[model samples]
Target: MKISDSFKSAIVEAICLLYILLFVYASVSKIIDFENFQVQLGQSPLLSAFAVPVSLGIPILELIIAFILLFPKFRYIGLMSSFGLMVMFTAYIFIMLYFSPFIPCSCGGILEKMSWNMHLVFNILLLMMAVCALLFFDKKSFFLRTKQFTVRLLLCTMISSVLIIILIFTFSEKIIHNENPFLRRYPPHPAEFSNAVRLKFNSYYLSGFADGRIYLGNYTTPAQIISFNSNLKDRKVHKIIFDPANTRFKVISWYVKGNYFYLLDGSIHKIFRGDIKTWKIDTELKDFPFFTRAIPIDSTTLVFRTNKGKKMTNTIGKFTNEQQVKVKYFEGLLQAQNEGVFDTDGVLMYSEELNKIVYLYYYRNGFVVADKNGKVENRGNTIDTIKHVNLKVSVLKNGTEYAISSPSITVNSSSTVYKNILFVRSQVKGRLENDQLWEKSFIIDVYDFRKNIYLYSFPIYHSSPAKKFSSFLATRTHIYALLGSDLVVYEIKNDLKKEMNSK
Candidate 1:
């Protein structure tokens, strides 16, 4: 049966009208919610690096193609263009489905409601319609040829489009991780919520982890300590029995490692040692210098941070209490951006497994790794883009004290190291992240410091609206967070463990 020319023309016109409606509606919807569309693009695993230009360019291109479809002479060209656009969209969905770390939400407008699988199916149907429309147009048109030739051409277009998307995916990942443009890639379920237990007070800070138990120290009650099993099932409170007879201790910090615990009071230059089993102070070491921060290296040595010389610049030093106090300062480990004290203030963590001391800057996106002897190993940057510290300081009263004059941005809030993994609680929100999620939880970024690569990030949801994440400790399989009066635990999923083990 031969189809009439008018019927064929009507069929082609109908398809063209459908495409015009689709493109115009999609383009207008994106334009109406331009900011949202851009944010969605920024979250795309394959298009994040090109989000700015792609977000602006895509809608304009769609509108132009829709206009072209309305003209009779350019109808064929419009159908071809629609076919190519649909091919790219389908290929993008395909890559996102198979290759992306996690799938983001669909594009704006009606498509936003569709699941990724449904969106892929819809794109494929539209793509087939484009091919049909081109075939039904005037048979003499160059686009119409032998059926086999047309199939081959369409297949080539699909393959080429897929390859292009794959290339973009590879390049975007490199840019997003290394030279990030403030975008974050969130892999699904890097850390899963396990359980939480509420504490008596909110002053508990993570002291240490040993013998499969999480230890916490209370700031308000300096000598009090709390210990919990890995699953938060078993909880116990212990106190350090020390006699404060003639010693004037201003601040006391407890550090537990292996089978011994150390009582350090840098303010009065005193060190107390005790056995973890007895929890009693048995010995007081002499020849210790006045310092601000200290971590136990062993039974005899300590890693301390103190003000150096008259400048009071923050410096790291190794202290040994064998016969005499031997202090060795690593002056170059910390680089200051503003006032040496405030700008260089950060979290000091020592990884016993790696034998590396990690100093994570509070206001910046960099960290320094050093060996036990204060030899610098690697200076690595976080996924954030803030290189310099944004701080404003004021000289107080007698010019001896310095205080922050304005609110400063904190990049990495708290961190802990377990074996080869470094877990950092990041304060700054990345591009395309949910504001509600940020309000309700703390984002923990995981990095393999041994490999010097970011593994993934996950959220530790707040136990209560009033409680904020203060400090955390990481073990081989669990991350214990101290949020106000609550101690929340998150189980490390196998996906993260595989990455850590692979390295």
Candidate 2:
């Protein structure tokens, strides 16, 4: 069928409107949840600094591009603007692909309806429309207008775009925010401590923020379990684990569950609530500076020990604890025999599934697993009769017996996190379900004692290909891997969905 000029113009206009709608929705959603966006940015060496400025500006730019394109006189100008914006976006993607290993979900709300690849394609399509609009040029051309009028209009357009860009840079964070978030509270309170620490095989890290509140996230799932209120000093979070032995809750590293949280700053263990906002001073210790392990055996009991974690911020002094809340520690392996040898800073794992704490130490022999009860079970040993592979271990369940999962990989040297970039060293290959070294990207290796075979792996990286250094999160049903601004979700295999077993 032959289409008329009017009909064609209307169709083109509708298409243009849809693109702008997407842009506006995408930009605005991210603006509303800018802090989450910042975390994503921080995960990348290049994006964090760009986050504040971009967060405020992108939405406004979209609004402008949308409004201008709708105007009959400014149709071509709108098209040109869209083209420029798309170019900027495409460039951002390529840059992220190379410099950053993970990506974040910058698009939220309405725009999230489309996939990332589709989002890119849509932007490119808009660029084409902008170009097409240029071809449809008819009204009094800018060149044909009086020189004075032409100059003024041109000047006005440039000024408008410039102002918009500047606003994006200046108020990007504020405009998106309905309220001032930074001035508000952070680091949740610690109330009770679960008598357990956990090992997170994957990147689903549940850590405490400085505000005595819990801070947790993963790339695969949604609904983060975190709450924050009060300053860092007033927090108490630490826990002690047991191997079929019950221990009292004392000043330890950290604890997580519900209605309870204990934190150990360098000097003392602060006890607070996961459900409440206030905190109380738990008993202070003598060798507080040297204290490391703190595990809660019951509601009012705990066992305290000393083990330094990775970052200074990771100190129990810095983290507020809660019941069943997942936590991780660097735990440079030490010995009960030696009072203090060179502390071995090991893998950073989290409390997941069941309050089991699993950590990978680069042992002179191999690695070991620290169960919820502080029992270090050797996963691999440099000494014979141990597992040598540096596998990713996950804390599965809790109770008399615990469930743990590990996905091993071969890596070279130490992992690196440069600027905002994360470079981990791991080598494991497998497909999504089918086993093919050639086809698998990120390995999701599952170890089922029920199956009697100890091999399972899958790639859980999002935004980019699954690699070391990329951050991730796990939910009941899915896993979300964050690669910079990209948030990729992975649903568990049907067979492994609810088939958790004890080791």
Q: Which candidate is the best by lDDT?
A: 1
Candidate 1 residue-wise lDDT at 366:
92
Candidate with the greatest TM-score versus the true structure: 1
Local distance difference test, per candidate?
A: 0.83, 0.40
TM-score for every candidate vs. truth?
Answer: 0.88, 0.31
1-503 per-residue lDDT for model 1 (tens digits)? 98887898888899899999999999999999988888788878789888888899899999999999999888877887888888889889888898777777679799989998999999988887888877677756554466567667677777787787778888887887667777765666777889988787887778888898988887789877888889989989888887878998777778888888888888876788888898998877776778888888788888888877655778998888887778788979999888798888888888877788888999999999999888998888888878898888998777667888986799999998876678899988877667777888888888877767765678889856788788888877888888888888888776776664553
lDDT of 2 at 283: 34
Error of 2 at 361 (Å): 22
List residue ranges in candidate 1 displaced over 4 A.
1-11, 141-156, 283-285, 321-325, 394-401, 405-407, 450-456, 463-465
> On residues 331-363, what C-alpha lDDT tens digit does candidate 2 reach at each position?
433331111212232344334334434333332
lDDT of residue 392 for candidate 1: 88
